[model samples]
Target: MQQEFLPQMSSATAFIDLSGLVNLFDFETKAAQAMSNLAYEYVVSGAADELTLRWNRQALDNLKLNQTVLTDVTKPDTRVTLFGHELLYPILIAPTAYHGIMHPEAELATARGASAASATYVVSSFTTTPLEKIADTATQPLWFQLYVRDDREFTKDLVQKAQALGFQALCVTVDTPVGGVRNREQRINFGLPADVVAPYMLAPGPQKNPLTWKDIEWLQSLVDIPVLVKGIMNPNDAELAIQAGVSGVIVSNHGGRNLDTVPATIEVLPYIAERINGRVPVLMDGGIRRGTDVVKAIALGAKAVLIGKPICYGLACAGAPGVARVLTILREELELAMILLGKASVPAIDRSVLWEKPDN
Candidate 1:
């Protein structure tokens, strides 16, 4: 039997501290109170008009789960294998930068929280904490989210370092050719505190030079572990990713930050999943707010889902414990949904779970 990994929070609780939180949004609300206005905005805001950002959540809401009772779900299993390690659930902590802005412990706290929850933590290239330090703190699987710098050699060096430090995989972020203009962030003059540092920088600044397919090939040539290309949103792109020999695809729109009006991650997931056709693992992240949301993504054929802003929200609320509480809530909700829907395991969730398919 797989070890029980869900945080035990069924006991009586009052709304006093992080333990009082019941859901991801609850953490988000608490985080807003704990963090500065600028910090909160930076974590939550989307690019340009913010239409895509709002749409991410709206798209998930549009999907309704069809419930089926009178079935035995007493032992419904939530375990899933990704990159050769079994996770307690399909929800992963997406790579968001600069945890220090949310809490003093920074990425280290996030790493510890993820391990406690038995979920994968993809450390961002822009992490305020050193990767080695985060690696030491992690008890579960750790993957590095890479943003290729202008200096190809430096980027390669970072890749080597991550592998040496025991990162299980490399999730290369490809959507950001350039930074998006988040009006909310600009209005606040948002910036990381001076003490926060990106440990992987050769020369600190923005990495504005665009990367091509050749870069992916070079990255793969350097690392023995799986290299999953993040930021894929189109079927054609998914096809290219397969041809390029990537181990997986994360169907993301950079959490609606890189471009406005792009299709929601959920909206584009099925098409990409079809194109990949099980050739590689297809994961997604954008508007995952509930356990039902996780069910919908898996039903549409996502191997797993990554979470970004919510982890920041949890970090800001109460460091590692807050993050664990948020994951516990999500895991419990997913299990409840699974049992209610008559699914025996993660594999039992499919397109049949959806009440009706929304028009693409």
Candidate 2:
């Protein structure tokens, strides 16, 4: 329990109210040093040109909100339903790997945070904790993220196992046919820490099969659960995902870790949303730091936005309590934004609330 953020923290806390444990930032900054170069890099790595990674934040800066005044928004219902499950809020914990490296608590802690925030947790395929156990720990619904595995049999087995354990959906990450070109993590020669090896990695590397629309079909065949393609940047691919009967598509560039000199996700989302045209839900993840960013993403046609990094940063600082604190900030910030904008329900948000910045 830590409560030193004060005044700014006080106003911020008022949004949804979580204090006494507000120093998740400071804790992560210190935790970064404790981690070996490899562990640190693996978690924090970004790509070449690093421009896309940075732009995730910068592009969000270009958009302006058309705040409505004097509307009756006394109670905003943040509840949203996606992939067949109704969530308390639209926020989902983006799949990040090997939480144990950052803290002993690992994914278990994250599950606790998402549960606390009433947000969904998307567990990474390469998780340090066993997936089933993480699912058991979750108080809220859990989704699974799949890396392209080299073994089709193994992939099928993984999906079956996830469903057996009650995961609600599968998010297949496609941006990394190969892992992202994380220059920072590279500089550190990021590798698994001795104490933090992923048990699943012992199985074998990902199947070298070239993923395509065909793979999506195969994936749908493997399970009854909803399938979401997680790395779509191109509208054509978005269309294909819709045709393949995916329940949703997430617009991500592996958090800008895979490509260099690419446009930020925010730069690509609106067009992708238009192409999909509501056939399948379109979700965005990458550079989302503010509640206003969530609003911007929703108006640009995101069904919901995924959050990464910040929760990990919070975890590095204080474990489950830290992550819960971070989510509190985001939720509060969003609630405040919704209230101020004179909106009362998540569905009420749409393109009308945003004005696009001309690409400079």
In terms of lDDT, the best-performing candidate is: 1
**Candidate 2: residue pairs that collide:** 2-20, 38-190, 149-207, 150-206, 150-207
Q: What does candidate 2's lDDT look like per residue over 249-270, in tens digits?
A: 9999888788777788888999
lDDT of each: 0.86, 0.79
Which portions of model 2 show Cα errors greater than 4 Å? 1-37, 202-207, 356-360
lDDT of 1 by residue, 195-223 (tens): 87767744544666668887898899999
**TM-score (all chains, Cα) for each model:** 0.93, 0.89
